[model samples]
Target chain A: MPTQANSSEPPELGLSGRKIIYDEDGKPCRSCNTLLDFKFVTGKLTGAEGTKPLSAQAPAECLEKLGTGTVTSAAIGESSSKAYPKEDPPDVNQLGRASWTLLHSVAAKYPNSPSDTQKQEMKQFMTIFSHVYPCGWCAKDFEKFIKHNSPKVDSKEDLGRWICTAHNEVNEKLGKEKFDCDLWKKRWVDGWD
Target chain B: MPTQANSSEPPELGLSGRKIIYDEDGKPCRSCNTLLDFKFVTGKLTGAEGTKPLSAQAPAECLEKLGTGTVTSAAIGESSSKAYPKEDPPDVNQLGRASWTLLHSVAAKYPNSPSDTQKQEMKQFMTIFSHVYPCGWCAKDFEKFIKHNSPKVDSKEDLGRWICTAHNEVNEKLGKEKFDCDLWKKRWVDGWD
Candidate 1:
């Protein structure tokens, strides 16, 4: 279900007459596919070209046509920007699941009454984490999330609830189900005994 | 398969003459279960107690005996330490997977030649990460991993390989299969296509 850059073309035409999802080296750009469309297009649900699914790997005529100087840089940029305004990378789902697991688990173990240093370090860690998160656009969104919500690190309960709400915001954006924040203790800390 | 604190104590005796995983407050300590044993013992692979599995949540008599001033604190500490030796919390696996996902993805996206500030921030992030990792003992092992290998952030390839090797080290300890470092890009950056 992996949609390569070579997934044919949409009805709309770009300046080059095709949207560019890959870079000049034929490497797929991390943000070229939104996780939503990435999920849909790469989903085997999309009809295949023949017996096999579409290979994003094919060196499309559009790719070769690019960098030939016939296509203006501004045209290509405008075209691509129109298509994937908020794309996630190919492995965005993998990255996302892993990040949530870690964030929630860390919040679960936070001290009931954290020291000032612990609280400060946690906030600082979020700042550093946002900077280093693999996906450029996703990181930008996380930065916004942190800026608006900030990290509530005063207590373990505070942090847990805050992170759950943060995760819900992401889920809502992705159109995924929002988890019950009340179940934070059951999911992260105590087993459902 | 979720083991609760009510599970009957192992045959091993502590100062109270019974292994105690839960604290006096009836809350499971974050470091009480190693991810290894957590996977195994809580695994459905283990036969159930009576069509039902053991629960770790039951307030065992040992907890009641602790604060009554009869049992010495030293004895209690010695017993618990001797049993776990090196343990990860209940959600260690969840945390571990998330940490690795973020780590590999970040490495995959690393610039071929990072600026000095970028390199320093990545290294500093690891140090802070090792400290804030949810699992107590797992963090210690990660500290050891960092001490020995250090973060190789010179280039994208350097960091990708380094992170892959680091992941292999953890896999070795956890009895998980080793990943091919050669496939770092294929797994983290690009799709199988």
Candidate 2:
């Protein structure tokens, strides 16, 4: 069984036979039921209207109306673990580590005296990277960081140190220990002594 | 002692008290000496000119001229493990995994019916991503892939399927098993069965 909340009707009973809880904004509380409930309620409120209640509907019927097309509870149950049968996708920490690696490696390879084209490309890359980064909140934060401390792409050393300092700022926000900016090359490019 | 290779002069000897090995293309072979050899040789070939021979140069002098500044063999030794002192940056495999996760997640979250702006943005993101991807060889390969099989971004399902197929191409190249495209939604967005 699933839960249901209608914006048109007063928030009362859910499809799971539990009372629907509303947030201060009068939207159904997301934590009240499964993610399906949240989607159903929000979907109804937004575009689709007068959808059949989930309690009275079969899974296929509900999925068809929702335009999700034949989702099964078994699939949802397995996916609840957040791992696919064959592989698990990277989480936030993994994404952070990979992104840092790419950034540092790029800095490591940045020429000491970049051509005008190279410098402009780097700038464009950073701007587009900030916009399209998968994590919306993290991307927004990075955009602000970039605005405050614009990329220094004049030289490799300068760019490396600038990026290191910026990364340290993120570390500070996350309560992680800050890295020494002076050791940027040693850590990222050349082997440490 | 660091090795030396001059593009002007024939590849002969190295400061490591050993002969420098050259690839078929006459570039210094990466396997010989250390990563230092590759950097020094390539650095010489590219920008810095006539930077005295490493054989005659002290570690300090070499570092200064190279603009790498005070790298020690011990530092390289530690970084060889691919882990920084405090943090381990993602290696190629880790980066691949994380990147795939981010790509799939983004595709999953893409709107079923996106605005023109969203469609253009996705296309632009892929183009920039191909250019700025940290791994140079991988970026070149992806560019080829993009050229051959352009992104299908009309709808969320189209985008997801397109990305999954692209990922499969990479997996195939890596000699990894291909994923069943039918299960993409289950694996990425809706849990798997």
Write down the lDDT of every candidate, Cα atoms only: 0.59, 0.59
User: Candidate 2 residues B1-193, lDDT tens each?
Assistant: 4434535775465432334556455755432323434445555323332344454435433433333222212222243434445332333344566577778867865778888878887887787678756555667888899999888889999999999999999888755567778888766765432
lDDT of 2 at A138: 64
TM-score of chain B as predicted in candidate 2? 0.58
The sequence of per-residue lDDT tens digits that candidate 1 reaches over residues B43-91 is 3222342234333443533232332222111121222223211212234
Residue-wise C-alpha lDDT for candidate 2, range A46-68, written one tens digit per residue: 33323445544345334333332
Clashing residue pairs, candidate 2?
Answer: A3-A15, A4-A15, A79-B191, A191-B75, A191-B76, A192-B75, A193-B75
- Residue-level lDDT of model 1, residues A1-193, one tens digit each, is 3333345652122222233244345543443333333323333223342134333443443332332322211121122223212222234455676787788878977889888888988898888788888766778888999999989999999999999998999878754566667767766786443
Error of 2 at A87 (Å): 3.5
Lowest summed-lDDT stretch of 10 residues in model 1 chain B?
A: B71-80
* DockQ of the candidate models in sequence: 0.20, 0.17
| Reference-based TM-score of each model | 0.63, 0.56
